[model samples]
Target: MIKYAVHILFLILVGICWTPAEAQFVNLQIRVEPELSAEVQQELDFGTQITNSGRSQIGLGDVNMGIFSIRAYYTQNVYLNLTFPDALIHSNPAIDQEIPMELSISYNNSGLNRPSESTPLPSEGGLVAIHENTTNLTSTSDIWKEMYIYVYGYIDIGNIPNGEYTGDIVLTVDYD
Candidate 1:
């Protein structure tokens, strides 16, 4: 029993002496960098601008149910015009939107506005309907000093208007 006890004590001592080293007392530092991308659009013909000066191409697919809403904003009275190709019905410049007055819509597509589609443009003059975006716009124009405007629209080419008109599309967004 005495020899056995001695052997066990020796074994314990050997085990303690041979023990592997353990990592201890470490100083660690960490940091985080967030990545972000955002968008804003002005020219409706082109896609919305995303973060900085990036541009996205706009197309028919973006129009929902063939209907579109556009807006324009200017500090003072501005001249907004629509044009028709020379071949179609004679255009009369007298027709225009008066102050606080912004845009004019054919209500329907005047096929003449586009290429071959000569069908009368849908009549949207008397009652112009522009759908509003439910989402609150987060950006502001105070930074850019550019006019902001909005217009409700649809593409109805089967019906022609008094004359084919040319119009510029506008999209309102929060950023530059």
Candidate 2:
């Protein structure tokens, strides 16, 4: 027994140079953008007024001011919530008239569409932050960015009882 056949040829050369261990794989991705919008270009008309005993104003560079357009994500940061209507009802549901109001807001990203060179916004609405205007940068508009909102108010026509009057102005935006 030549040392048991050289220990069976060194266990068949260590089982032919053994090997058993392998696992390597990797792949991952992500891209989700599209959600942050507000568009009402204009609609807060305070026209036709006649019953003055007091406040019946409409000044915020009034052109029947009410123009909102905010489509963000170009470095997003926004929060505007305005839910007006203290009083102004009587679309003639038998005319149980009511009129007494006061609302106000303003904003402009300074891209200059001129909402009367807007600024003041705190009649209750707040936090509108988005600043990175590299001359209104555009590599095909850089993934959207536009801000402008203005809505004027005032109406305490003390002797109320006209024919038509309506209310409801709710503009809520998020992501602060």
Where model 2 places Cα greater than 4 Å from the true spot, the runs are 1-29, 39-52, 61-69, 73-87, 90-95, 100-114, 118-141, 160-166, 170-176
| Residue pair clashes in candidate 2 | none
Quote each prediction's TM-score.
Answer: 0.17, 0.36
Q: How many clashing residue pairs appear in each of the predictions shown?
A: 31, 0
Question: What C-alpha lDDT values do all the predictions have?
Answer: 0.30, 0.76
CA lDDT, candidate 1, residue 94? 69
lDDT of 1 by residue, 39-157 (tens): 23322332222223322222232332122222322121222223322221224566442111122222212111221221222322222212222234456642122222223233222
lDDT of 2 at 77: 76
Cα misplacement distance, residue 39 of candidate 1 (Å): 14
Q: What are the RMSDs of all candidates, in order? A: 19.8, 11.0
Alpha-carbon deviation at 1 in model 2, angstroms: 38
1-176 per-residue lDDT for model 2 (tens digits): 99999999999988887778799988767886575777787787767778756776777777777888887766677878789779989887877768888887888875455767778877667777654463556585565777887778787776767678888878787875
